[model samples]
Target: MIAEALITLSKPKVKISPFMKVSNSSNFQVSEFILKGLPGIYSWQHWLSPPLALLYLSSLGANLLILLTIQQEPSLHQPMYQFLGILSIVDMGLATTIVPKILAIFWFDAKAISLPECFSQIFAIHYFLAMESGIFLCMAFDRYVAICHPLHYPTIVTDSSVFKATVFMVLRNGLGVMPVPVLAAQRDYCSSNEIEHCLCSNLGVTSLACDDRRVNKICQLVIAWTLLGGDLCLIILSYALIIKSVLRMNSTKAATKALSTCSSHLILILFFYTSIVVLSVTHQAGRKFPLIPVLFNLLHNVIPPALNPIVYALRTKELRLGSLKLLRVHKEYR
Candidate 1:
C-alpha cells in the first residue's frame, strides 16, 4: 500500500480543459531582432568602420556648420538658404538614424535591437528620405521662380511662403510615411528575427517575417512612388520652365547667367538622384550580389549629406564670403 501510494503521488496530474489545448502552430512574433550585418563579409566589417566613421563625422560637422552660418548671417536668411538649412537638418537625421547603430555593430559587435527601437529607426529613415524629396521639389520651385520670374520671385517666395512650404513638407512627409511602420510592425516574424541589411529599411525588415508580407511590400512601393515619384515629376516640370525662360533670353550671356544660377542646385540634385537610381538598380538587378546594394544604400545616406554643404553653401559666393568674414570676426574676438 505504501509503494502504491508513493507511485500515485509521483504521477503527473494533467489539467484537461476545453479552452486549453496543445498548440502545433508557431508563435510568429518577436521581441527583438538580430541584425545580420553584411552576411558574407563579417571579416571586413571592421575594415568598413574607418570610412563610415569618417563619413558620419563629416556629415555631422558639415551640416552643423551650414546651419550655424545661416543662423549668424542675417543677409543669408533667404528662401533658398532656409530650404537648404532644412535639408541639412534632414541629412543629419538620416546619418544619425543609421550610422551610430552601424558603428556599434561594427566596432562593438552589438547586433541585437528591440523591436520597438528597430521600428523607430525604420520610421525615421523613411520620414527623412521623404522630407528630402519634398525639399528638393521646393528648391526646384525656388530656382524656377528666381530664374524664370525674377521680378515676382521675392514676393512669391516670401518669408511667409517659405514657412508655409516648410510646414507642408514636414506634414506631408510625416503623414504619408505614417503607415509604413504600422504595416511593418504588424508583421509576424516566426521564421527569422534577423534583418539582412545594414540599416532598418522597410523591405529589409519585412522580408524577415514568416507570414505573408505582401501588404507591407505593397504599401512600401505605393509610398515610394507617391512621395519620390511625385516630387521628381514636379522638379522636372519646374526645371523645364526655368530652361524655357533662359532660352527665351536674347543674349547668350544672359541665358548663361540664368543657367549658372541653377548649376549648384542641379549638381546637388544630380548627385541625389544618381545615388537613388543606382540603389534601385542594384536592388533589382544585383540581387545575386547583396553587398553591392547594401554598400550603395549606406553610401547614399552619407555621401549626399557630406556633399550638400560643399555643393550648396560653400560653393555660393555669398555664403563663402560670409563664412570668411565670420571666421575673421571670430579670430579678432579670440
Candidate 2:
C-alpha cells in the first residue's frame, strides 16, 4: 500500500478540463525571419529592382574611381584627399551591406534570412553608419584647420594624424555599436518572424520579441545619439568656426574662395543629415505612411555614395583633372 502511494505521488498532479487547450508557446521560437520588402506593394515590388541595381552599380563605380584616382595621383596625397579615400571606402561598405540583399529579395523572392545572419547584418549596417559619421566629423575638422588656421594646417593635419583618426574611427564605432546587435539577438523572438523592413534594422528586429524590448530600444537610442549625434554636433561647431574665420577676412574675393572650398562639403552634409533627421522624425511620430520612409531609407544609402565622387570631382578642380587623366591613361593603354 505504501509503495503504491509513493508511485502515485511521484506522478505529476494534474487537473484537466474539457475546455483546456495545450500550449504551443514552447515551439514558437523563431529560427529564421522573413523580410517583407516594401509593405503594401508586394505585387509590383520587383519593378524596383532594376533602378536600384543601377544605383548600386553607379555607387560602386564612382567610389572605386575616386579611390583609384586618389591612389594614383601623388599630388592628391594630402590629408583632405586621404579622408576622402576613407569616406569612399566607408560608403562602398555601407551600400554593399544592404543593397545586395534587398535586390535578392526583390528579384528572386528569397526573403528568408537566418537569425544569425540577420543579426550580423544589423551589426554591419550600424557599424558602417557610425564610421561614416566619424569620417564626416574628421573631414569637418580638417576643413576648419585648413581655413581657420592655415599656417598650422600643414603641421596639424598630417598623414600621421589621419592614420590616428582612422584608428579612432574604427575602434569607436566597432566597440560602440557592438551591443546593438547583441541586445537584439538575445531577445526571445516567439511572437513573430516576419520583419516588415527592407533590411534588418535593430528596431524592426527587436520589436518582434516576445519579451519587453524597452531596454533594447533605449540602448539603441543612446548609442546612436552618442555616436552619430555627437559627431554631427562637432561637425557643426567646426563649420561654425570656419565661417567665423572666413568672415574675418577683409577681401571679398578671399572670403568667396574660402566659402567655395566648403560648398561641396556643405551640400554633402545636408544631403546625408537631412535624410536621417526626416527618417527619425517620421519614425518617432508614428506616421501612417510607411512606404515613403522605407523608400527614403533605401535611397539614402545609395544616392550619397553615387553622388560623393561626382560632387568632389565637379567642385574640386584637382579631382576632376585626375579622373580625366586616369580615364585617358586607361584608354591609351587599352
Candidate 3:
C-alpha cells in the first residue's frame, strides 16, 4: 500500500490533453490555436467571404497590372516607377499574408491554425507592413528630391541608388520585424489557445499567453513606432519641404503640376496611416465594439492594395496611358 501510494504521488495530479504536448521543460505547450474571427456574427460570417475574396482578387489584379505596366513601359524605367513597382509588390504581400486565411475561416469554418503557421503569419504580416512603410518613405524622399532639387534629382535618384535603397528597405524591415514573432513564440501559451482576433496578430496571440506578456506588448509597440512612426515622420518632413519648394515656384502652372504629381501619393499615405491610427485608437480606447476594430484591420490590409494602382493610374497620366497601351497590345496578340 505504501508502494502504491508512492506511485500515486509520482503521477501528475493534473490531466494533460492529447492535443497539447509536454516540452523539454515539462510545460504544456499549445500545438494549435483557434481564431475566433469577428465576434458575434458566427452565422453570417460566411456572407463576408464573398466581399473579402473580391477585395483580395481586386488587389491582386490591380497590383499585377501596375507591375506589368511598369515592366513593359520603357518610358517608365525611372526611379519613381521602380519604387511604385516595389510598393505594388509589398501591398500584394501585405494583403496575401492574412486575407486568404481569413477567407478560409469565414468560408469553410476553418478556424484552427497550427502554432508554427500562426507565428509565421505574424512575422510575414509585420514584415510586409514594415516594408510598405519603408517604401513609402523612399517614395516621399524621391518626390522631395524631384521637386525641391530638380537639377540634383538625376544624380541623387539614379537607378543604382534606387537599387541600393530597395536593398536597404528589404534588409532593414526583415531584420527589424523578425523579433516580434520570435518573441511571441518564446512566451508560454499555457492559458488559452483561442485568439480573439481574426488573424494571429502579435497582440492577439500574445494576449493568450499564461506568462506575463508585457514584454511582448512593449516589443511590438517599440518596433511599430520605431519603424512605422519613424517612417511617417520622415515622410511628413519630406512633403513639408516639397510643399515649401512648390510654393516658391514663380509659375502657377509649374506649381500645380508639381502638387498634382504628389496628390496620388498623399492620398495613399492618408489611407494607410489613417486606418492604422483608427485601429490603434480603437484598441487603446478599450472600445466595447470589437467588430469595429476588426473591420478596420481588415480594411487596412485590403483597401490600400486594391486602391493603390487605381489611384496612381487615375492621377498619373503616364501610368494610365501605359496601361491602355499594354491592354491593347495584349488584345491584339489574343
> Best by lDDT, which number?
3
The global Cα lDDT (0 to 1) of model 2 is: 0.87
TM-score of the candidate numbered 1? 0.90
User: Model 1, 16-41: lDDT tens per residue?
Assistant: 32212223376334667888788579
Runs of candidate 1 exceeding 4 Å displacement: 1-24
In candidate 3, what residue range of length 10 has the lowest lDDT sum? 14-23
Query: Candidate 3: where is the Cα deviation over 4 Å?
Result: 1-27, 285-287
TM-score head-to-head 1 vs 2, winner? 2
Sort by TM-score, top down from the best: 3, 2, 1
The CA lDDT at 232 in model 3 is 100
The deviation in Å at residue 201 for candidate 2 is: 0.7
**Can you write out model 3's per-residue Cα lDDT over 1-334, one digit (the tens) per residue?**
9999999899766654432334566356677899989867877888988888989999999899999999999999999999999999998998888899998898788999987888899999899889988999999999999999999999999999999999998999999998898888887776578877789888888887777789898999999999999999999999999999998999999999999999999999998888899989877643587777777777777788889999999999999999999999999999
Model 2 bad stretches (over 4 Å): 1-25, 285-287
Residue-by-residue lDDT tens digits, candidate 2, 227-282: 99999999999998988998899999999998888888888888888888987877
Clashes of 3: 0
